[model samples]
Target chain A: MWAIQLFNGLSYSSILLLVALGLSITFGLMNVINMAHGEFLMIGAYMVYVTQHLFQQYAPAAWFDSYYIFALFVSFTVAFFLGMLLEMGLVKFLYRRPLDSLLATWGVGMMLQQAAKMIFGAPNVAVTSPSWLEGGLQLTSVVVLPYKRLFILALVIVCLLSLYIYLYRTAAGRSMRAVMQNRDMAGCLGISTRKVDRITFAIGSGIAGLAGSALALIGPIGSSLGTYYIVDAFMVVVLGGVGKLAGVVFGAVTIGVLNVFFESWLSASIAKVIVFVIVIAFLQWRPRGFVSLKTRALES
Target chain B: MKQGLGTINRESQFKWIVYMLILGMMLLAPLFLSDFRLMLLAKYVSFAIVAIGLALIWGYTGILSLGHGVFFGLGAYGMAMYLKLEASGGKLPDFMVWSGQNELPWFWMPFSSFFLTLLLIVIVPMGIAYGLGFLTFRNRIQGVQFTILTQALVLIVVTLLIGQQAFTGGSNGITGFKTILGYSLSDPTVKRVLYWITIGVLALLFALAYWMTKSRFKRVLLAIRDGENRLRFIGYNPAVFKAFIFAVSAGFAGIAGALFVLHVGIISPSMMGIVPSIEMVLWVAIGGRNSLSGAVLGALLINYAKTTFSEAYPSLWLFLLGGLFVISVILLPRGFMGLMKDGMQKIKKRRKREDANENNIDFTFGESKR
Candidate 1:
């Protein structure tokens, strides 16, 4: 029971972390809170739904097993390009004013959700896991974990690792770090902060796309699925300490475990209430977030 | 002393004119509009009250609270609980019974009395805002962080309400309210009276808020908005002031919620969701965030446009709203009031320039004659 619960918690945390990392990167680096971040995830899920339907109808039966992989790539590309377009057209101009960005993006989010409803209909779309990833791995008589969930967990780790490398090892990564540290100083040093911002936003949105693809495998897709995750993603960003990768991981795991344990003990609603109470308490202690940025000047 | 006395008399006359105008309008509105339109206007008046509260906080205090819908929701639910109890008349509300609740919950008993429920409607939201402000402001949370925290609060409250279907009436929310304060809500006469009462209350609240803005306390709020650190250096604890204003704002929002329930006869969770909260902010932004009258006018105009546009072009309304928000943020940062003020200034300048040109022409002609 403990092992199964642990696995469940980790898988939930992995998905949350993936979704929140995009928000954190955008918020932490650009100081812009993209309230429409969840819509990106929703778009990715819709893309997967469409791709899966197309593949099932047109492709050979043998290629169906690898459809999930194809969906992820397609969704990522679509969301990434869209993210770039959004950044260039809207977000870039609103960099200095974070609060306005929040409101504007919220408007954008509503438009996207309404558009999705108009196109996809209001009902939730049905998605199926690949045949190999279906069913559970039975460890004992009362202990079973879904294989798809385990796959999500593995995917999270791989994605995080690649993200870590891309953020730390590459020259662009260094420039991004510098810009995040001090935009004016980075600009003075000849760094193209605009280029870095666009790239970072695209990558962050791509991760959200990946999260959406994973979410389709786990549950139903709908126009407002993003709304459900948005609050949770914000909580993760807040709890993890804004702008820190490690904080995102920690926050996700803590919230995931607490949610599962509380749901087991109490009703789901009560568990969510308790989680929010905990987050409120946590915020009271560290308003800036769990991990404060290294530069003291950025405190404002 | 004579000049001061004259100024005082002038101000009093101005106030009387304004009061009489409001009284006349309120008395005359119900005569012209149908009951349905009267009810909608009452709803708009309630929203105007909420917008007034928002103006006090966002316009005066420079704190944009994204969770005001939570306060509105709490107030609505508080009144709904009372109305539902009265509707049941000593039995459990239908939803509770449907959820297998045999007895009335102990906490819900206080709301049985209309007076106590009205008191709770104001108190509950105020209490929550006070507690939240005490925790958040003291910790120095501001900017995007504060905004996100408020959004989280909205989410938690909304999710809790939705999930606790038995208690909150779930996604459908509490409806079917038949009466308020023993007055039949469905009766046209009763609704017309309520509409007058809403207008009166809104006028009184607006007057009080306008007076507060002209007070010394409001100066401190503006100071804090401009430079909290500087205000702190002058020995004012910004958190205390922020908390006080937050509670006051929530109190007004609570009253608006109660008024809203009276007018609409139904209160849904969606009414207090993030969307509505953002819309409230937009109203203030478009009306002129720094001006009290602007807030009220903005709320009425925007809501009117919303109803009209949605009715005319339901499919394109979202895009229009989105575009409005984007355009207002980008171009009309100071809002309609600012635009009006700027226009007035430009006219005065042009008039002065014409006077200078006329003087130059006259002087040159006179010199030629000499």
Candidate 2:
């Protein structure tokens, strides 16, 4: 029983980590709070829904189950382009003002949510998981691990590994890291800070999209789905320490474990409240969070 | 220097007259407005009170709380509990009975008294704000970190409220009050009285806020906003000051919440969630954060606009509200009041220039005579 609970906690943490990564990345890079980050995730989920419909209508019967792969890519690409467009049109101007960016992005988020409501109607739209994801890996009579969760875990691992390579191995990643370390110094070294910011923000948004795509497999997608997850995602980013991947992982794991542990004894909402209190209490001790990078930049 | 002081005095005098005129108009609004319109105005005025508190903290102190609705809700809930208990008349609230709560919870015991409820309305939110502000500020948490923490606080409070259905009426929240202090709530006369009481409280708080802004404390707040480290170096504890102002702000919000409950006749968890909390901030942001009058005007105008817009074009309202947020932040960072101030300053500057040109000629004559 404990093993199953632990697995469930870990599985939940993986989803949280995915959602937090995008927000942490953009926030770390630009000091801009994109309140619309969640909307991008929603867009991604809707894309999956769109893909599922297209596959049913156009694709061969045998190929229907394979549409999940195409949906993930489509969601990521669409969200990425939209993020880039938003960066250029709205977020770029508010780069210097973090608070203003938060409000503006929130406005953008509201508009997106309203737009989604108009397009998809108010009720939650269902997207069925592929047949291969059905059933569980039966370990014991009392404990059976779901295949869908295992798939999600695998997907998360793949995302993290690829992200790790992208950040550490690539030249663009090097430039991105330099900017994150010190924007002025990076700009002085002839790196285009503007381009880095746009790409980084878009990538973060795309990550959110991917998370949303994964989410569609688990349950129905609604206009408010993004909002429901956004706060929790933000909590992960904050508690893990902003701008640090390791911090996000640590935050997610801690929250997921604590949430599950408390949930076993209490109601879900009460458990969530407990987790929030713990996060706030933890911040009282470590205001900079668990993995704050030492830098000379006073404002940062 | 003497002329500058003279102009400042005259400008302040003009401002007071305008304040009085606005107050007079509000007092006389019942004559022209129907009962429903009067109720709406009262609701907006209560919001204005919340905006006033927001202006003090966000505008003056440079601390933005995204969970102010938590404090507002606390106040509203306090009032609602008292009213709810009174309505029940020695028995448990209807929801409590329905939920199979045999006895009133320990927390609900104190709210049985009307006076205690009123006191709690101010004190409870103030206490929470002080505790929260002290914890975060003492830890040197500011800016986005502080904002995120407050947002989390809202989430916690909302979750807790929703979870305790037996105690808090769950997501439905505390409502269905038929009377207040033995008076029928449905009576138009009672509503008019409540409206008057609300305005009176608002005016008193507004005066207190104005006085605080004009005091030496305002300079300290501005200094903290500009340079907290420097202020600390100068021997002033920024945390204490920040926490105190935050507490005061929460107190104002609490009062506003109580007033809001009276007018709206409902105190639900949804009203104090993340969206409503942020919307409260929006009022301050759009009105002009630094000025009390601007904050009050912002709350009134934006809420009025919200009601009208949503009623007229429900689908497009969010788009317009969103556009307002973007436009206000990007184009009018200082808000409508900021724009108005700039225009006023420009006219004043032109007048000063003409006055200076005349003085220059006179000075030249004096030099020649000497």
Candidate 3:
């Protein structure tokens, strides 16, 4: 039972990690709040749903087994481009005004949710996973690992590895890192900081979109699906400590484990309340989050 | 100096005229308007009360609390508990009985007294806000952390209230209120009385908040918002002020919640959730977050628009509200009142520019347009 629970927790942590990565990258790099980050996830889920419908109507019977793969790419591209457009149109101007940016993004979130309702109707929309992704790996009578969750876990690892390489090894990634460290200084060093911000935000948003596609495989998609996961996603980012990838990993695992364990012991609602209370108290203890940024000036 | 005094006097007079006009309308509204409209106006009045609290915190102190619904809920629950007890004829509330609770909970027992209930309705939420504010503010959790913490607070309170089925009515919430101090709540006369009382309470609170804005304390709050470090260097602890205002704002929200229960005949966790709390922010944002009058006016205007739009074209309501949220922050950050204030200031400035070519008349707070 404990082993199964641990597996469940780890899978949950994958989703948390996926959500947090996008938020942390954007927030750390730009110091701008994307209150509509969850909306990007929502859009991604809708993207998958739309792709599945279109494929079923137009594609061959043999293609049904791999429709989700096409959906995944489509989700990422649509969300990536939308993120770029939003960054250029609105977020770029409000980069210096964090509070206004938050409110504006929240407005965008509202509009997106409303649009979702208008287009898809208010009911929860979902798509079935491919036959290859169905069922679970039965290691033992009591230790069954679901293939869907395992696929998600594998996706998380792949995304994390790619992110690590892109952030640490790639030229653009290093320049983005320079911008994250200090915008003016990075600009003085001849890096195009605005381009860096736009790329970072787009990448971050695309990751959220990918996470949403993964989420659609596991559950229903709705206009307000993003709203449900958003608070928890934010909790992961904040608790993990912004700007640090390791901190996100640490935070997600801790929160995911605690959530599953608490849900097992108590009711789900009570567990949620307890988790929130713990996070709030933890915040009091470490206002700079689990791992404080080395730059003391920004902490203030 | 004489011109400065003259402008101050003129401004005060202008403010008094506005207050009297509102007060007169409040007093005579029931006589002129239909019962349904009077009831609607009462709800808006209660919302205005919440906006005043919001303006105090977000506007004056620059502390935007996203979980104010928790405070409002506390007050509402407190009032609802009292009303439930009264409705149950001193027995267990209906939900408790249905949930197999035989005895009244210890917490619900004290609410038997109307005065005690009223006192708790204000103080309990304030107490909660004080406790939370002390930890958050003393730790210097300002900006986004503070906002997120408040949102977390709302979620915690909402889930707790919804989870404890026997206690908090479990999503159905504490409702079916029948009377207030032996007066039938459904009675039209009683509702009219409640409406006037709500308007009176709001006006009184507005006056008090307005006084606070004009006081030395307001300057300190602005200073804290602009430069907390500089204020701290001046040998003042900013946490105390923040805590005090947070508690005060919570108290105001509590009062509004209680008034809301009286008007709406229900108190549910729904009113204290993330959406409702965000709606409070929108009210102040639309009113002009920087002005108390703007806050009240914004609440009335938005609620009126909401009801009108919902009744007419329900499909367009969210779109309009969403647009308001985006536009208010982006292009119209100061809101309607702010725009009017700017326009008024510009007109005043232009007039004074002409006067500069004549008598060079410009002085005091009201004359800053020049």
Which one wins on DockQ? Answer: 2
Error of 1 at B196 (Å): 1.5
Q: Provide the TM-score of chain A alone for each candidate, in the order shown.
A: 0.96, 0.97, 0.96
Worst 10-residue lDDT window for candidate 3 chain B reads B361-370
Encode model 1's per-residue lDDT on A37-155: one tens digit a residue. Answer: 88999999999998988899999989988898999999899989988887887889888888777778777877888899899998999777789998988889888888989888888
Q: B100-197, model 3: which lDDT tens digit per residue?
A: 99898889888999999999998999998998898888988787767877887887788888989898899999899898899999999999899989
Q: How many residue pairs clash in each candidate at the backbone level? A: 0, 0, 0
The DockQ score of candidate 1 comes to: 0.54
DockQ values per model = 0.54, 0.70, 0.60
Positional deviation of residue B88's Cα in model 3 after best superposition, in angstroms: 0.9
Residue ranges of candidate 2 with Cα displaced over 4 Å: B355-370
Which candidate gets the maximum lDDT versus the true structure? Answer: 2
For residues A1-300, write the lDDT of model 3, one tens digit per residue. 888888888988889888878988887788776888989999999999999999899999889889999999999999999999889988887877777787778878888888989999989987988999999999998788889999999999999999999989999999988887777889999999989999999999999899889999999999887877777777887787777788889878888888888989898788887787787789788876787567746344
Residue A149 of model 2, lDDT score: 86
Please provide TM-scores, in order, for all candidate models, with all chains considered together. Answer: 0.93, 0.97, 0.96
Worst 10 residues of 2 chain B by lDDT: B361-370
Error of 3 at B17 (Å): 1.0
